[model samples]
Target: MVFPERFSNLPEYAFPRLRKLLDVHQAGGDPINMSIGEPRHPFPEFIGRAISEALEGFGRYPPNEGGEDLRAAIVAWIARRYGVHLNADQHILALNGTREGLFNAALALGVEEKARQKPAVLMPNPFYQVYAVASLAINAEPIYVPATAETGDLPDYVALPAALLDRVTIAYLCSPANPQGAVATEAYWRDLIALAERHDFRIFADECYSEIYRNTPPVGALQVAHDMGADPDRVVVFHSLSKRSNLPGLRSGFAASGSGNIAAMKQLKNYTGAPLPLPLQAAAALAWRDEAHVEENRAIYRRKYQMADEIFGNVAGYQPLEAGFFLWLPVENDEAAALKLWREAGVRCLPGSYLSRAVAGQAIGQDRLRVALVAEEQELQRGLLRLHGCLYQ
Candidate 1:
């Protein structure tokens, strides 16, 4: 039997690779997991009641597109958060999670043959693994751009060669970026939107971490696009309840794009997607409608950030995060640093290289480790202190 060549060169998923690297060693102290970005915050208390009330509907099939009420709730949230009003019927589609929507959108909209050559999908080096998988699934070439400190930790697609840009079909961007915690500026968004328009590619803005910021709320891709009067179809932003409402288990998220893109995605979903179950949809609606819990969750993250700052502040080469929940600390080598931390400190973290690939004559994430600040306050503090002592001290 022949295996697909598309996955032949693909690296093992992060967690499995991590286990292989550290499973042989015994932790030196009590374990403190600061590795995965799974939120440890409390979800809404009302989710159970909402689910119980709507449980009967589960016997029936869920709508391929989201239920009207759920869609409206998402619309309202978008309006409140981004000031971009979306038509629930035309511009919103609830997802199992943003990952599903993000991956499926590529299949729905990414056209490899339409480009002057084999289409290229642009993504940050240390990107969400789904972006590369989706690009490969569609037979498009995935171009990994370095999102290192030299580039402000955001991929500069505008800097790509015109020949490559002309062949580009989609660009995946993450604001309050994963593992690195870097947020793109409004000016950055404007430049990117202009590039997309000039090159005729769509921007898949993955803003799942939009709600988990420190200072002011991060500027959104849709908001910037709308302000510039850019073509709505040029940018499609994906948001989720996972980080925002501390509801990762709910698998609730939505995509907001131009009517045409949304329509195309809806049609594709009708054939291959399963929308949120009714009870889950109801729970998500309530979650979206409430901001109090989100604020509370933000407070928790803020506290953890301060704890990380206090613990790692004196350590040389520690780059305190500006947004998102991860600390991207410079080290001699990510894999070795991660192993040492796990073995000596019992603190687990991801090697930065696992999140990125070498591109344009540089191994973009070769000298850093990504420490997720998703544990509880006390645990997070202890983990940061251990990381500081193990890696920096």
Candidate 2:
């Protein structure tokens, strides 16, 4: 049998591995799932009407990049949100979801070799899985940089040895990071941009959770790049409607960068991309233009964040999340704590070790559990309380 050895070494994905560990034991009480980050808030009321009006266009092939209205809406939103001006034609390309762009952009931009060695893709140790897979697909060495508590939950790419940095072609960064909710400050972005310029690598900013923060908006990579007058090609950002508009099923997102980067991505997409159905794209366009729904969504997440703080506030190692909804709560052992919570209370949460890899002898995510606060307030409260009782006490 022929098989691709490149992916054979990959661990079984997070959810399936979780099911194997916990499904054999009956949930001790009414099950409350806090494992997945899928948003539970209501999508905007206008989506149905918008989709209905555009239904006829589904009969025709949609544009590979995006229709004019959708592109304009994205550009306008960027201006309003980040205070950066961008040309719709040169700077943006619609994606089925940020995941697609995040994966494909590497293929489009990563060269076969850099500085006489295999190209390297830098990523946080406990990162979104797609980043590693993208690097593997291209045979690039996926360098897992530790983004631990000591590093403020963001990768310190600048500290890498200059020789390794010089071989790098891309670095993936997520702010309001998944699992851990720490955000990158403007100074953080500025330093990173400078580092990328020095090393000659492009920055892939995954800002999917940008809109789900409490209080001040997180600083964006594009804005910082613009402020520093960095080459426009230095940073490419991918954002999603999933977290912002509570539209995970919509599968709508966009990537923005210098024209050269966008053009390269567009060329690749022209051959193999699955453009969103015209009807869905219309709904997404409306979703992007309207800030009212996004604000309401943020308000819902804000209240949840408060509930989480109150429930786990006194627990010894609970880090108050700055943005994003996941609670990366500390534990003596992640897998055992998850099992105890599942067997004693019907609370389902993921063991953080599954999201990270071991380097040397220590796994970065071994002492934590990633709990999603995506349920309604009352249900979320019950889950968190049960988790607190079962794990903390």
Top-lDDT candidate index: 2
Q: Name the regions of candidate 1 deviating beyond 4 angstroms.
A: none
lDDT per residue for candidate 1 within 1-393, as digits (tens), equals 887898788888989999999889999789888879898888999999999999998898999888999999999998998898989998888899999999999999989576457889999988999999999999999999888888988998888999999999999999989978999999999999999999899999999999888888999999999999999899999999999998899999999999999999999999999788999999999999999999999988888878887887887777767788888888998899998898899999899888877767678677888888888787787888888888776
What are the lDDT figures for the candidates, one per model?
Answer: 0.90, 0.93
**Candidate 2: 10-residue stretch with minimal lDDT:** 1-10
Please give, for residues 235-346, the per-residue lDDT of candidate 2 as tens digits: 9999999999989999999999999999999999999899999999899999999999989999898899888889899999778889998999999999999999999998
RMSD of 1: 1.1
Per-candidate TM-score against the hidden true structure:
0.98, 0.99
- The ten-residue window of minimal lDDT in model 1 covers 357-366
Q: Which stretches of candidate 2 lie over 4 Å from their true place?
A: none
- At residue 17, what lDDT does model 2 achieve? 98
